[model samples]
Target chain A: MTSDRLAPQRVPIALGDRSYEILIGSGLLSLDGAWAGLPASADALIVTNTTVAPLYGAALAERLQARHRRVLTVALPDGEVHKDWTTLNRIFDALLEAGCDRKTVLYALGGGVVGDMTGFAAACYMRGVPFVQLPTTLLAQVDSSVGGKTAINHPLGKNMIGAFYQPARVLCDLDLLSTLPRRELSAGLAEIIKYGPIADPAFLDWLEASLDDLLALDVAALSHAVRRSCEIKAWVVGQDEREAGLRAILNFGHTFGHAIEAGLGYGAWLHGEAVGCGMVLAAELSARLGLIDRALVDRLRALIARAGLPVQAPRLGIHRWLELMRVDKKAEGGEIRFVLLDGLGRATMRPAPDALVAEAIEAHTAPS
Target chain B: MTSDRLAPQRVPIALGDRSYEILIGSGLLSLDGAWAGLPASADALIVTNTTVAPLYGAALAERLQARHRRVLTVALPDGEVHKDWTTLNRIFDALLEAGCDRKTVLYALGGGVVGDMTGFAAACYMRGVPFVQLPTTLLAQVDSSVGGKTAINHPLGKNMIGAFYQPARVLCDLDLLSTLPRRELSAGLAEIIKYGPIADPAFLDWLEASLDDLLALDVAALSHAVRRSCEIKAWVVGQDEREAGLRAILNFGHTFGHAIEAGLGYGAWLHGEAVGCGMVLAAELSARLGLIDRALVDRLRALIARAGLPVQAPRLGIHRWLELMRVDKKAEGGEIRFVLLDGLGRATMRPAPDALVAEAIEAHTAPS
Candidate 1:
């Protein structure tokens, strides 16, 4: 008797001794085999948020219960802003109260907020516990859920506090995205578009052609996009798991993007939205430096616009942008490193002159 | 011209990919070349405590300034209870205000409290940044400094929040021990005694003979003890960087010791004080189970007593002990796994019978 259930794809992040796998696909959340890799007889803690609990908490409990004798769930307020120490303590309290052990596996079951917070909690719980990611948003599915970058944002900077903790398994269910709002969908597409330019030009061209289909919630288009993005992320992470060298390329538009996010106040702009606009600015910067033609920059901006994402920065005022960007992680000793594109698929980290960066910011923020 | 400075010993941890070196000796705090392995052009943030800043902070700052163009330091309150999110944010604030970037390196300059907090802060700063350990206390230099177990205490449990973040370099300066109080000296020796049973039997025998000399501040005896303990810890951490198996051996006395610390309230008992008493109880429990001869337990207790360490539990009451132990990381599904000695130089994890554990607790708390 053969079953028709699709097998989960496990993408191994090779950090040598510190390496782990990212388990991708739908319905894996309900599999006991997923918990088999964890310590035997260990207690399990499901960390979800208010928005995710109503949607999938019961089902997750049922799945974990089949393998583990005891299980507990803690749900926190859902939002990027809530991913701070205050919200993180709720998990600490629940684990301490429930007598959760070092071997306890913390299952993160939400978007980037839940995943990052859960990962940080796991990193700190008992000085670290076994944790698995059950990411439930399109943006998390394609990006945040794969890498080991777990953090809580500080008021001064985005993701200013966190750890490079690799999850034992990252269970990404594509079906969960069916409930995501339209704006979130567009925001997620920004990351999906990102993978193409930094790693695969062909993927970028395919994304441009299938932008409408993906926006319409076409399953095949979405799956392909998610798979390709994960593959690129896995390969990059495998080579530079700790963000040493090659990994900087993966942050193609993130330098400017993080600055934008911090300038707007976290949660004001979705991570992907900031990244989308940042990618356009990077392209313009690349053109100004004569690395890529100005026509290519227009093409990149047009694709971003067609996908319903902002191709320009919001009116944050240039001074605020410079102040925010100066604290960005990508900046080094007063020099801002921009991940500028060499062509459609290739990118490099270049030190942009302050005057040119200011000019790009001015152009992008101008009306129309 | 030949300088009179002695070269620091680099103890190599042998795990193939996750291998690291532990530098031991005095004056390592003044070596900027110690940070050569970290990413280039990275800004640095030094996380310390109030007590250590006045002692070694200026010297460390001068050395770091010679290496990195920008270096910032944040001094936190000294104590175990303050090793929480509130204190962690102080470092985050300095990093943000100093405009620290992702590649920033954090230097932990103090005792165990400062090292653990600094390593944890580095683990969370920008999702992760490289950190170096400049352990300035006998307890830190001999024990906490070598291992990567970084954490903060939760109200409900000690070390309930933390991470296993490794440092790029560990500089354990023996000269710093000159300033450590005599009470703290005995507290640090408890961890030194721990190394013998778990990994080195000869070391245990040697420690028993040299206990008085070590207490008398015999430099040769103390240096040998510190070096051996670091070698064992580094080996275990190297073998199981994530505590999969071999690394758990390092926690032989920690499972029970942590409970005692939390039961009495964090900071109420010095970590080594609790561990010294916990090891005696663990040996007794082992003897009760026929895992070791009664003479082994008696010898262990005698050695602890000679070192001026507690061999009995404080008056926390049995009910509180049970409650705190239940929340221990070694616990799984209400069954606590105690690390008991099989012999004078061997330890193993087993689920202790409640009756035996209760009896042991009763005996430890008896008036005598």
Candidate 2:
């Protein structure tokens, strides 16, 4: 249990027939042995970004080629800005060009953006096909890669166009995070910290203790963080696979987070960074609603600031924030819905009154 | 059932939670009563093509407006050529432009092209939303609008990029097909002829007997055909929704049909036209495999020809036909698979040897 170098840990996502595992550890890309008996498709396509392909493209393809009759790779342009329909169609172009059939299995080999677009491509490719997530970035391994929410960004809203398409399996290689930038590493921590306020307070405390090791790229810390996050996500999704009810709790800060991303434009702030600030805003809103105390908000803000994520949100203004938040997919009947903490480690969905929403936005916005 | 005008007949597609009904009758659209309690979304969006919108847009909007808080319309350019990412995104653009939320319900109001694009749009819009199929064309009412297989075409293939998303309800108003052009009526008949070879031999006999009445757009004939086709489709999809096993039978001629559509360019021939010709090719292939006799092939050819669908297929060279069909989503392990008839009524999927496929193609091509 203590030894962590290259030892793969499997976390099963219990989704009945759609269930698969999240394999977390080091050197998973080169471990051809794990590739056995899982999705024995004759054809395989690996979708990655420009930054990731050159690093491990050949090795990944080589591993897949050992078992598959054919392996094709499509490297997309990097970053959140490219998560649009045009860029998404490029993967479709490659799949169609390769004459890959429905039996073809897609491997998404980058961060959340890559995993999302590839999962979506698999979902729509011939109506439905199987895909695996080889999420390289920590943000993906902990959050996006675990859940089946695959989407490309719409001009008006982030992730506004997508589907809840589950992957065949998820392989989270801890070694991949070694080369991730410090800023991205902190970004991933935002997601790790989110699990605490909404579902598990104990996980939040462990994250506080291990943030330093995770930021330093310690394999055990990274592995534990990814595995625990996936376990929580799997449990949540298993109960409500389609965000029917319980699943919305997992999107604790996502409503505010999505507004920020859409407001400032997608790439201006990293997704996890927006969510970090978003969680603070949600906590503030919770405090305003008399659900959680100010102390909890203060503690959350402190942990976020300490983790190198932004504690204060951007000044999108009350009106603009209201407008952008209304565009959220979670919103219904012109009412902006939010997932707020009932108390530390528990969440509930409710539509905040317009006045209170404005007040919360004002409280979160930094003085400029 | 006896009284023809405005007598509503419902065909329930039992898909567990995602299940919905297909309401077939005359004046179903204008009957505001039928629209009630369906998709009770605050926001309703009607996605129709330029051609069909002018005919019934105002009436449809009026019916939806009575129930919905807000009603919006996005009219795409008509035709199979427009059923791609560009046209599909126009719906998204309007959805975002209107600040429509997740609870918004979309109404697909046109042929298979419109129904398919709208369904896919509904599937991906905010990860999913409720949608109703108000199919105007015969092809859509009989086939595409029922099964929940929604897709947009890629440059390389028809229905290449899509999803398996069901609609909240399907309203096939027999009146909508009255104004349908003769060519499109024949196109719709292609899908009707498909049900016989795959599941129901009696439905085939009935279709053959009433071909003239259907071609003439008789209200009773149209109503019966739409209901029977949907009933067959519903039964098949209920057994196998995602084309895992039993659902493949629904794609009787689609493997070859898709190649025809892809090879000639998506809009060059109507989808039904391709399927009509493809059915002939499949029957010939079926005879080659000894799964069905020459009499059955001749019977299918006569019915397809009398229904005004193409009995002769395009002379795609053996190399080209092989290349194209291999790209079909149905193909597996580099082998071209076909849904061949086990007898007059039952269908089974198997890979026909390449030589037999080539020979069948040669047999079906015109003498010239």
Candidate 3:
């Protein structure tokens, strides 16, 4: 066991009356002290999935059982595509059979899929049970774990059904990423890179320089990236946890990326893969609008390509893209809002014309 | 239409951190101004049940349409038994098909069942969307509407699955209750009587005295009961919205009542009816503990009986009662926490021994 001297830190997300904390650190899974911050009770259910159970479920259950008199674990099928109401109902069924109560705390262990499912389950279980996020994937650690966005993908649209439920604590154990596949690690980096253009320019520079070290899986590089990304997300989430205003900036590439994910079907493309390509397209769109220099857009695309991510959108055609983007959560009335870059680090939401979007799609699919 | 000036008043639930308002009155739903308080640029989905759609869904959609560019309504199956993940998914499916955005506001228009399902749906939709409660039942008006306890019943338990997502505005339309069935009206009174012993003693006495007028559906008496009950609930919820400490007092009869509801099966008895009987049993448990005068327990039973609710425990037998009670949300670490009265209007939670609980059940159900 690692030394327990390093204390976990909590980032307070201020939503006026709905503020909560995002706990950040490693080895948090073994800490009973972290559980104290949750709603005081002994009855809790740890909602994980098949992929995460072998790695962390037993240890987590043991820790919870040490502190709590009765601890139960419910493992579901693991996959991004499996994050749906039918899968969520399995959790409800377990909770009901266990006679779980309002005070019961649900621990979400695994990557984004498990965390998303657990948060959604907690949000609906008995109306709502307090849940803590034990994010085990890099994507979950740097991005999904911090924001209160919890949801399941609909067949028609990815993340179409969901809620903004802030977890009581977000336990990000960097050690968990040791087992993550290489593709997943790269996917998680896409979101880490996203925080740069959308919020912090300095972080972007750091990421650009540390790309090799991060890919090499250096602990310091990974920690710095994860911490900085969390800080940016924490600040944005704190300002607009419900995405009423500033939070929209976090979706810099998500509008286009979600369409790609939905267009190809949920599991066909990893979320971060689509996001990486979508960010490049969004930068191109920004350059066309004269919001950013074309050189900078090329540089952004080059970096994404160097990192082994796609820089061009899938060949869905412009019309399908328009239809898909229309169903985005960012769409208002009938108008679709796009979060475009104002500069290297600043992004703003604006409505774009159909002709420009069509041209961008044509360019994206025009043989690279 | 009644004067728009007579819109519902907001009662701010003043928790140090998660404080919010409970909007009470009539015609509040018809006002477009209320929608402005929600998150910007999001679509709006109104979730009502079959019973409430024809009554007020269109009016609500019309009001929201004035401020929102897109507003959609989904009507779910009515009744407590139907409030599950399956029905909840119907709203999720509709939102996805309609391309509802992340900022979409879900309006819950109905009684507790509608409010719970809509709130839970909102909590899960896009992770969560801002939701407002348009409570239309007497019971919901005073109790469920004010508290953010959103959930659906499981086959094994009454409110086995749920979340604690607060509504942006709880629009209590008293006029809608006029169409509620007489049985529902009577069932609601059981909760009305709950406020007295848990928090306010004078309120209990007032309820006992005004029982006839309230039962007769006198508008003034109904208004007073609804308003006062909300006040008590708002105060309790304000202190502990998640039932941490002060809110446990509000569950004076819920521990045993939930068991009865689950044992008899959900929808078999109106929630209020089971609660009424459970209150009698809780009072008896209090007497067994020598915590309260037996006469007061009998008085509590009489009041519940006069309100046309069952006061005697059903013949599910002691073993079944224990099994059901074990599943109560109040049970922590496998120990039953009973909210027993020290006196009429004063309650506290303590672990009751199963032997004593069995003895109390025998005392309450023995042929006498």
* Per-candidate clash tally: 2, 0, 28
TM-score of 1: 0.86
Which tens-of-lDDT digit does each residue in B1-368 have in candidate 1?
11235566677766554456777765566665555575555577778888988987888888788778887888999887688778878888888887777778888888888888888887778777778888877789777756678887677866667777778767776767777887788888988888887778899889988988787765566667888998888777766777777677777777778888877766777888889899888888888898998888788888888878888787776677777787676676677888888776777988887788877767767685
Full candidate order by TM-score, most accurate first: 2, 1, 3
lDDT score, candidate 2: 0.87
* Model 2 error, position B40 (Å): 1.0
What candidate 2 gets wrong by more than 4 Å, as runs, is A1-3, A251-269, A281-290, A293-298, A312-339, A349-368, B1-3, B251-274, B277-301, B310-339, B348-368
Top TM-score prediction, candidate number: 2
> Given candidate 1, what's the lDDT at residue A195?
85
State every prediction's TM-score relative to the real structure: 0.86, 0.89, 0.84
* DockQ each: 0.73, 0.80, 0.56
Which segments of model 1 are wrong by more than 4 Å? A1-42, A253-269, A312-327, A352-368, B1-10, B16-18, B26-44, B62-65, B68-71, B197-201, B244-269, B284-298, B311-338, B350-368
**lDDT (Cα, 0-100) at A211 in candidate 2:** 76
Tens digit of per-residue lDDT, candidate 3, span A44-138: 88888898899888888888876666898989998866887688888888877776666788888888888888887776665567788888888
Tell me, what's the RMSD of every candidate?
4.4, 3.7, 4.7
Query: What C-alpha lDDT values do all the predictions have?
Result: 0.79, 0.87, 0.79
Residue B126 CA error for candidate 3 (Å)? 2.8
Question: Which 10-residue window of candidate 2 chain B scores lowest in summed lDDT?
Answer: B1-10
lDDT of 3 by residue, B1-368 (tens): 22334545556766543455666565556555555566554478888988889988888888777767888888998876688768878998898787666667888888888888888777767666678787888888887867678777666765666677777767666667768887888789999998888778898899889999877766557767887888888877777766668788888788888888888877788888888888988988899899999898888888899999988787788888898887676777678899999877788899888888888777777483
What's the CA error at residue A127 for candidate 1, in Å? 2.8
